[model samples]
Target: MSTSAPPDAPPALRARHLRKQFPGVVANEDVSLTLRAGTVHAIVGENGAGKSTLMKLLYGMHRPDSGEIHLDGEPVRFTSPREAIAAGLGMVHQHFMLADNLSVLENVVLGAEPGRAGVLDLPAATRRVEELCANLGVRVHPHAETGGLSVADRQRVEIVKALYRGARILILDEPTAVLVPQEVERLFVSLDRLRTRGLSILFISHKLDEVLAVADDVTVIRRGVTVADSLQANEVSSRELAHLMIGAELVRTERPAHPADQTARRVALGLEEVSLRLSDGRQALDAVCLDVGEGEVVGIAGVEGNGQTELIECAAGLRRPDHGTLTLFGRNITGTTLRRRRADGVALVPEDRHRQALLLEAPVWENRMLGRQSAPPNSRRGWLTRRAARRDTEHLMRDYDVRARDADVAAASLSGGNQQKLVIGRELAAEPKVLLAAHPTRGVDIAAQQQIWRRIEEAAAAGAGVLLVSADLDELLSRSDRLLVMLRGRIVAQVDPRRTSTEELGVAMSGAGESAR
Candidate 1:
């Protein structure tokens, strides 16, 4: 099945000599690429390397200061995203843009909704969505509430949303960041199906293996400049691509040596027979007992929505379980408030940074004081001080290598990777007894991921227990001393990270080897 376009065919999308500048920074300069029809063209770069800015310019979210954009070989200019969509371009942002309260059908037909003489045509939209999902082999019920869907299903809904709008080209940003190994395979299959139908995809990802796996073309950007363009993906190795992206030898994050054995170490976090029932009458968590000893890293692997979120929330004191005993250092803290947990040396890096960890409109300094407003440095003698907050913000930025003009700038202005770094630094700076991190390095590039891993391991080596939940099997295999598999609200397996293979772990996650413990 040859998906490549003929040599004589015009590119589905092309941008040449693209240049964009913002105050105090040049976001993208000299960026250019041609996305051939029926092929996946990948764009790779380090954080702040201008890939996002370039995509923005292409999607018409931000108009280029100077450049030429051609859609189907005709020069055009798009003033906004609406214009780009009208011109057959669609973009799926890293953070999904969907109303959780709505059904999948409602979310998909929201913008270009069908109408029969001023009346919403719900049936027509549902049929169309159903057809699109079937064609793409995406199994999502159109009428299902979006809030309850798995992460993979939500992503499928977003993709189908574009197709419903008649998009010929799609720009996917980190599409596989939160996907398991199996889910990643399914997504690639869907992308292949898209390619067969002559749709073009501009893939942006930090995972080099994914880019090499599915992309037909590769483009590299460094410091807002296009370092390389139109490199054939099949001819390039992951090592070669890594070098091109960062212009340095790629040193993959090396996991710190795992502490020898955990029998003697005291428990930092302990959960005994925990169970939770959601308001929807769904059993979100079965009686799950767990323990993380001081200086140990415990990794949880499961498909999204298989109770990982609930587990983390319960551990963080955001959710009160129906029946459970949560102990910190052998002391019951099951009913403790989130603030109490923090003060008791439990630090949490929540999964959703935007909703849980940060105020987008606030400056970096204010965000640094978010969870610890009453703690020392942030406050003294029960009074918060802006001066100390600002000082700490400066320190975190410097230490974490958060790229920003200054701490006074709004957090919304930093790149996603930088925002993630900021949040991790804010949490880790407390040096808590336990670190609860969920997908902490979701959207970051290679170098930033290394730094984050190093920090988390340093905390563990300092005798702080860490409970890590991630979709990245490699991270779990490398960083964790023990890995737990979750399925249908219960832990079904616990395997030694050093002994089990990722494929076996993926099977355990799916309930095949449910009792692999």
Candidate 2:
């Protein structure tokens, strides 16, 4: 492990011969990367290819078994994330980490509150945060509560928090995954402003098109090692990069054509004026009415925090709506348990796989066996069937392209995208009549995304109704026959995807004008 760059005018950050080994997996093996000063550098790879591992090593979440990290031409070792931050490095995680009850100003200056003589200086902290936001062209109120802000606004607060701490090098992981197309454009604009001010950015994303669009240099890693390093961003196309990632040509995604006869099929899922009151007494959903026929895909498009979670919970039987009715295949299931809903051929793919869908510490087989304990193969007469569960897990791992050494591996060891695949695979294997897919392809690689979409289409073709909730406009526009727009806990507009544009959908989502309900 040695630095390759010349000592004069050292790079902002560099890693040489980095290696990290887990129990049964080598997360990174002899990986090296360099980020020049004042540039946006991107790392791209398929899921479970050690992209997150490498970033964690750099961020000091995990120490490499063997490697040398260099900052400004000097060897360095960080014992914790705090040391990394003190060294002018900051990381914005894929999932935001702000406290919901706190205000924007408090969240920004949480660890580094300004004070004198044990007295907190609120006005000074607010002024500094406001200045940082103004510099970055982000619009956010310091007094506003974190829980009520939109996803895009919360992301801006994260970025401003990093800048407020005097970070010279920033790490952003999958920043645009939850944002609409318009919000992505705004993020790129802020990144450009930061880059011009001599800040170095390390961007980790599964989206090739976005990497190519925003990065100054691109690096590709495969199988826990660097295959391509410091390639000029303009020299490679997304197609070539995709091929390098998976060792094959990229698969194109096209929506399957719905049968004309299926248009009048039985309703698999129906919501009549569904309204919900959250535990915190918020009106999360209000008078939401929708229906998905058998063999049809109905998409819901909205900015995050706009009643999607409540709607999914209502459909999945995780929560009982305060008013209105929910029906599964013409059966009213408003008062049923979650297990009973699943027994009635209802399956759900939750938005946050780690929180709602997976047992992180459990083995893959055990995780696959969850929620089906009362059914055949998984269990019989309340007795577990280990052999049958193992067989099914192996098949799902192979079919879903979940990269892992074996079914005995812990679910937490796999990458985010792989975890998502396992959750979806388990739900789909039940052959449910109705599927609740919330951000199904949010963090997955291109190859896995295509596979997931194909499976959804196949399920719909097999007479399963799908409620597709996604922030990706293209995903909704292409896969959905009818698109519903939600704003402020209400369904404001319903548009035909074939005739709608992204701009029009964005307008409807933002509630910029009167609704055409």
For each candidate, the alpha-carbon lDDT, in order, equals 0.91, 0.89
TM-score, candidate 1, is 0.96
Candidate 1 clashing pairs, residues 3+ apart or interchain: none
Error of 2 at 41 (Å): 0.9
The residue ranges of model 1 lying beyond 4 angstroms of the native Cα positions read 1-5, 121-123, 256-260, 380-384
- TM-score of every model versus the real structure: 0.96, 0.95
In model 1, which range of ten residues has the least summed lDDT?
253-262
Name the lDDT of candidate 2. Answer: 0.89
Error in Å for residue 87 of model 2 = 0.7
- The most accurate candidate by TM-score is 1
